[model samples]
Target: MTDAPLSGLPLPGLPLPGPLLPGPLVDDAWLAARLDDPRLVVLDATALLPSPGHDGDYSSGSGHAQWAERHIPGSRHADLTGELSDHEAPYHFAVPAPEALAAALQRLGVRDGSEVVAYDSGGGIWAARLWWMLRAISVPAAVLDGGLQAWEAAGRPVLGEQEEPAPAAAGPLTPVPLPHAWAALPDVDAVLRGERPGTLVCALPESGFDGSAPTRYSRRGHIPGSLNLPGRGLLDEAGRFLPRAELAARVGAVLDDAASPVVLYCGGGISAAGAALALTLLGRDDVTLYDGSLEEWSADPARPLVQQG
Candidate 1:
């Protein structure tokens, strides 16, 4: 909440409070070099974005099954829907309280000074969510560029046998209160009222943006005044994020200024994280995710939505 600059913490190739470096995306070569570092922690944050009429339970998703079948050697599984969220909430992907998140990371052997690298089978969609969540809590984290696909392309080995992590000892895992990392319903309302100085970005595909696609929500349109920048487009043919200049060009069109705040939302909040990460890589740090997204927005009849087709 405070405008104070973030403390200088060393990220992979960048330091906080200074100019952002290339990105938080870690390639297989970089990860391979640090694989045996005692302070390093690898997490398979695989998850399936739910579709219309699909079961909302993340436990039933293919993420866990895939982790069981094959995963990066020594990487632990982090359940986005199960242990990382408040399942009782009305919508999915609701960010958990700091204590709850700390406990979950602790269980996965994460602690202070542990540099976390998250990867998933589905490019970095699921992994970016976990990375954003960790950074929201002020933890040093990065996403595996192109995720499992990139790892395989680099000839990295994945193990079929699961390896359990040793229990983490107690240490300082304090979470700095960063209110700007998340956007609540009131924030969206402020955006709608033109009282906020920011842009609203819809991270869903064009079908959903244009109201032509069927959805599970009560309504089938997009938030009024939102700009469409599908999460899928954040990556290229190889599933890696576009080069910095290219990323800046794509997102710069809708954003008035590089430093202006932007609120990102998708069906839930999963893909929104990808959008947020892309923005971060472009040096637009004033980004937040609308956790409830369409699930809450569309269900509210009073909320305004602009439809097309």
Candidate 2:
């Protein structure tokens, strides 16, 4: 709401704001070295999706309990389905209002100059979602590649429930919206109807895209005219992203055509962020995420979702 800078010239340990994050995707090594840096704000943005056959209850699948049990040392838990999301929205994990988001991040110790690194317990989807949200609001942030699993694999020690640190004092943050970072229903509709020049990408798995797998959404398939590129496919066995060449090989066709922007969407916009992160790593900047994604698209009877041929 207020554009005023955070008061207090120098917080006890936090240094003055430094440069923006190195990039959108930071490795475990990059983060390990900066764990003690006052300017760095690490977050455990872990939110689990419902298991197969379970009710599609996003709230019930929150990762707060897992975060409370164990998490990256000095990192705060970001409740993606709760405080960080818009509860009143029809879709799960909807981005909250700018002011509300700023408030939430501030409460998590995000100051104007803070460089945030977000990681999750599962694949990097939740972390990428948080990174995308922060980027949309002009925050300098990055997702921890491979997430907490990689951190552990690298022998990084985590803090248990008994080792949790005291909550940091709230700080000031100003939200500067990046309009191009998001695509709404109208944007997707325009792209589908040939009124807009953009690529519609579905980040769901092959089965989900082809209507062969059970889905939590109202519909079984993907939006018509969308390309299939599973978000998880971009990762290697260790959950780290594949090398740049391999990443380009998988995503280049859809992204290389500079004539149109790439509009990415998924079940509820969570996995899509992972795809968006991949594109970012590939050095593609002309990408936008469909916020409501299929959860909103399929819910509408007027919208068409077609099975793969």
Candidate 3:
């Protein structure tokens, strides 16, 4: 009876290719059909951290290098940190400047109206981030449901060699992007500020009070008044998301009980996006992210922390 939360919105939602905008997520098979199509744009959104000590097994760089080495055969690279982030905010991979994003996509063969798909090897963290930004600006885009690992798991194929730039699409996207500013991130100041009057959920996992060395932070604790919600519960063994039935049950409890102004955070800003995206799929739109997260909070030297001692 009531209107669907995302019923008429043109800027965000699924892997929809509609009149006013594109979609937020897509499955692998849908993308496979148009892998090499010129009108379609496929941007690799892998984020690589330095390998722990292996022979370049699967860091983000290695993933890109691997892609160049072989991809869907013609997919272009969309560096998550560089192409999507402005680097001006404390959040490492926050959204990039609209003009910069437009130009970068153009260089990567993306033009207005081009169907875009982003993916990552690191459990969809980077992939979802890129997808979120594109949808924010009414760009037609989606995330490779399972991501690179799934692509590889399907025995699809990969490229370990460099290739030339893919051809550009016809729909040249205007730089008239939407704004996704955080209105200034929450710092140590946020913790001391007390909870907002309405509803909000803390996505941080509840750790045991037996604090050892502070693997979680510079201080080894959590923010004041935060309703601890472990992000790991949102994923399964292989690092992909849990089924919708399970996801709805878990997240719904929070939404039904916790306040509507849902705020997600992790050790840093990365994992929070995944949880938030999942919530978005569940049709809860009144959500915001505490960009600075516990890292910024603990490091500030002036914030109060509920340590597990």
Residue pairs with backbone atoms closer than 3 Å in model 1 (clashes): none
Report the lDDT tens digits of candidate 3 across residue range 1-309: 111122232456656444321345555655665575545677777766542232112233335664576566567777765756666765456566677777777788777657678777777866766766676666777667678777777778676667656466434667665443232344324434654443334555555222232334556666665665556577777666778789898877766677446666665565666777787777777666665676566667776767666
Off by over 4 Å in 3: 1-23, 37-39, 50-63, 167-172, 175-183, 186-217
What tens-digit string does per-residue lDDT give for candidate 1 at 20-120?
21247777877776677666789999876556652222223537778878788889889886888887788777788888888888888888777788999
User: Scored by CA lDDT, what does every candidate get?
Assistant: 0.80, 0.85, 0.61
The TM-scores of all predictions, comma-separated, are 0.87, 0.90, 0.75
Which candidate has the top score in lDDT?
2
Candidate 1: stretches off by over 4 Å: 1-23, 53-62, 167-172, 256-259
lDDT of 1 at 41: 83
* Window of ten residues with lowest summed lDDT in model 1: 1-10
Predicted structure 1, TM vs. truth: 0.87
